[model samples]
Target: MSVPLFDAATPRAPLREGLRSAIDRVLESERFVLGPEVASFERELAAYCGASQAVGVANGTDAITITLRAMGAGPGDEVIVPSFTFYASVEAIVHTGATPVFCDIDADTYCITPETVRAALTPRTKAVIAVHLFGNVAPVGEIQALGVPVLEDAAQAMGSRSAAGRPGSLGVAATFSFYPSKNLACFGDGGAIVTNDDAIAEEARILRFHGSRDKIDYEQVGYNSRLDELQAAILRVQLPHLDQWSDGRMQAARNYEEAGLAELASLPKPVAGASPAWHLYVVSHPDVKRLEGALAAAQVGYKPYYRTPVHRQAPMLEWGAGVDLPATEHAARTHLAIPMSPGLTRAQADEVVAAARAAS
Candidate 1:
């Protein structure tokens, strides 16, 4: 039997009854964009994350850019970002016209540490983006002590929490993506910015709709990045199930641990006080290529979250010149994401572990 990397269908099938009705309701109302459903979902999401406000947007990338812009990040400013994260994190920084200063990630957590952020800081540093990579929270409390605004990129960490707080409530502002594959997924692209600061929330709302506070007036130049009503409704349907899905993913991670896969590779290490969402079950080995080949032969799906560190990407090389990120480079070369999702069966996880052992 072929085991795919993610079985979105299995988990989604259970929600089909409610999803069909939700879609029908939207179609009957004929309200497709920025409608009541979007507002309702935003409220529900904010309440879930323990935030005071939430504003829905087009995608996760836009959430970061809009939040940065609202926080006064622009040209002549610098934003510290993790070199090991998805390229979209850096891209959002660039969109705000602020330089992205690359920082190395912690070898154990695979997320940036406060020490790395401090080393990357410059007088021009205006803000920091703390990415909750692979569903594990970054050290928000330590980074916040640096006295600059911190934006939590919780795109992969919907149900995660740290001792500091839930992902959305930890930073000055946080971003979430419901990109069909996240812990709390929608039917299509959707995102939101959650914050406790009233000023930031108000600005994000204006900025997401072409800088318009009202239909006839434009406050500042902004982009069209509103989350559509359909996606919002779909997200609402899935919101209540997020914790259950997260628990299932956590169980899968435990299954991997119990399978003794650690003999072949290193497993993910959650932060001491963190309750991770376990978005991906990633393992690392010096010989990742061999492990991948074995999984392929066994018809078990596997892939690397990031094979190339953002700093090593061609477009980012110039920005990363003279910067050294040993930990990021090592993680990029070694980490491999095996089949991991609430839908993954224990038998399937065992199959993946068996393949890894054979390769080792």
Candidate 2:
């Protein structure tokens, strides 16, 4: 039997009953875009994340760009971000006409700490984007204490919490992606911006829809990035089950721990007060190439979580030309994402563990 990284179909089967009904209801209403479904979903999402408000957007990248624009971050400003994270985090900062100051990540957490952000800070620094990488939350509280407004790139950390609080509630504003692979996902592309600041929330709402509260009135320049009714409806059906799914992923992590995979490779370390969403169970080894080859032979699905850090990417060369990031470079070469999802069965889990042991 071939074990895949994630089987969206198996987990989504149970949601089909409610999801189909919701889709039908939306079709009958004929309110396809920025309609009742999107409004309700926003409210539910905000409440779930312990935020005062949430604004739905077209995708995660839009969520970040819209938040930065809403916060008045633009040209002549710098936004600090981790070089080890996904390119979208830095890409959004660049889109806002702000310079992205790449910072090194903590070797253990694979997350940017307050020290890193502080090192990268300058008078031109306007904000910081703290990414909750691989389901583990960043030390957002300490970073926020630095007096810079932090925007959480929580695309991979929907159900996660740390010592401070939930991802969305930790920062000044938080962004989420409902990409199909995320913990809380829609069928297609979707995203949201959550915040307690009324002004920020209001601005995000307008910015997502061409900077207009009313359809005919244009208040400011904004992008066309509204979450459609169809995707919103589907997200509502899956929202209720998010915690349960996260729990399953945590159990799978425990299974990996019990299998003593740490002896063979480096496993994720537990944060003292964190309850990670377990978006992906990553393991690192010095000999990652050999392990990958063995897994491929056993028909086990595996892939490098991030083989290239953002700083080393061709387009980012101009920004990071002189930067030296030993930890980020090391992580990029060693980390590999094994099969992980709520839908993975015990038999599949055991198969992965056995294959990993054999490979080691």
Candidate 3:
């Protein structure tokens, strides 16, 4: 009767003792900023994602900004991104002194496609950020085939995979978020940049700590952003459980489909050979308002997000000029996310299913 969109407490219950132990370890170490825990988490994260290296940063936005700057994106350099994604994607491009060229999403997957990237291409296109929105892995392999560097905002897709590989290794560089609500969550805000390219990873490492490998020299202008030791330790505890969590979410998504929500709405569809972690379980219904009403009446949590596409937002409006995004517009008008979490129970899921059916 009272299902929340994110059940943070439930997911961490089993790991409570481990989390406490991690915090105790960090407290005992007394090396709070960028210490051994961060190093170990970075190494373990890279290994998990099948990448050569991973650099921890303060948060997901900074991870993207640092990776873009490391990849040589600067003023006048344009990065292609889908407007249907979260605003932080574009904001990161802006922070790196690069222009964000907003594009459309594939109506089904709600992700940018190789075709969309092709449509947004120009001589100044420095890179393309393929966002794996709602845990559906973007078509990174196909996008890379276009020969432009691809940066993945894999914030919602830490455990998701495609035929080529995992999210972190699919693009030229990728970013992951460990916000408490994320699948691979931490105690607080944290993020990482992962890549097979050692050079980019090295740059990211420097960028994460004020442009200096050692404390002595200030090599380049960089923000003071580092994932502190406590958060890193907490993330380490959760990282080992991420694969199992992702599997649970995938199964929950299947349950929704089997319960007949698919008959009433357009469910998220993964690309060929991709396995989405079902981060948000967003759906698009023709009468989305009705669905919203049903969920509300049933005391079930539902969210209508990105109703205003990033291009329409005040700060990024100029980039919207003369840009066409009918698909993005359609998605913005119709889509909403139902309750989904690794800890979501079948009874809670059934409550959601009943509400969705009520809408129909």
Candidate 4:
């Protein structure tokens, strides 16, 4: 009974029938590029996020890169990003020729804090990327008030809610990923950018398709980033089940929370007004090495969300003088992501909770 950190195969299995049918339809139709399926899914996803428009792209990294480029961020400008997120976040900023100002994350939520953003701000800072880390929305509203355009990195938070009780509508643009491990995953890589701004939306749409406004008329020097028709069809099939899947993940998290492992392991608490999508069930402990070993012995799985913060990585974008991020550094060292997916059975969750309690 070896539990991997994530088993995307289980959740994708239920959609096999629909996926097969959709694939066959795509093959028969022969309209494999950005067509009806892609457009329809974009519309549906926009509505789901309470945004006026959504534009699909090749993958999550492309989604961020194109969105930033479409928003007019380039070479000399600076974009503030979370130091605790995946490499792709900063990579996207660098791909645009824009510099990324890395800011530390909150101790609890592991998302960039407004204070950190304020400290990192400069005259060249044009935008802030608020990453909804681990399915919990960050304090985007506060970051917005800083007089800079905000980009919501909702990659792990497709169905997440903000502290204001808003559902994925806090920035000039919001991006979502449909990687295999995401709660609302596609069979392969897929991503979208959601926004209420019509101009931004239109720009992103055009930019995604080689900068073509009409047919072969290149408006700007954009790359090929269109979302494939097949991926869109898969997303259309999975969209309806996202909230239901998120609910199940939340229930599993509640089981761990109620287990009172906080007494021994440092458990994460949900923000005051957030309805997190519970993408990953993370817990921190100073003795993470010992605890993770115990879980491995019990046949449960765990892994650190980030072993090293972004600023410490080799790809050093021209960020300003680095400041000590003690909390972020500690979290990078101590945090562990437990087995958490909608497909995780109650028995499995109980087993994980029991293992955690014993390790504690």
User: In model 2, which regions exceed 4 Å deviation?
Assistant: none
User: Per-residue lDDT of 1-360 in model 4, one digit per residue for the tens?
Assistant: 466677767766788898899888888889988999998999999888888889988888999999999899999999999888888998999999999888888888888778989998999998999888888888888888888889988888877776564445788888888887887777789999999898988888888877888766788888788888999988898899888788877877776666655676777666557788788888898889988988988889898878877888766634524657777898999999988877677677667777876666
lDDT of each: 0.90, 0.88, 0.90, 0.83
Candidate 3 collision pairs = none
TM, every model:
0.98, 0.97, 0.98, 0.95
What would the per-residue lDDT of candidate 2 be over residues 1-360, giving only the tens digit for each residue?
388876667777888899999999999999999999999999999999999999999999999999999889999999999888888998898888988899888777788888889989899989999998889898888888988989999999998888777888989899999999899989899999999889999999999989899979999899999999999999999999988898888887887777677778898765557788788888888899988987888899888867888878888887888888788888899998888887676777777878887767
Local error of candidate 4 at residue 87 (angstroms): 0.3
Candidate closer to the true structure by lDDT (higher is better), 2 or 4: 2
Each prediction's Cα RMSD?
Answer: 1.1, 1.3, 1.1, 1.7
Q: Note the clash tally of each candidate.
A: 0, 0, 0, 0
True-structure lDDT of candidate 3: 0.90
Candidate 3 local lDDT, 172-247, one digit each (tens) = 9999888878888877888899999989988988888789989689788898889999999998898888888898
Model 4 weakest lDDT span, ten residues long:
314-323
TM-score of 4: 0.95
Summarize candidate 1's per-residue lDDT along 43-64 as a digit string, tens digits: 9999999999999999999999
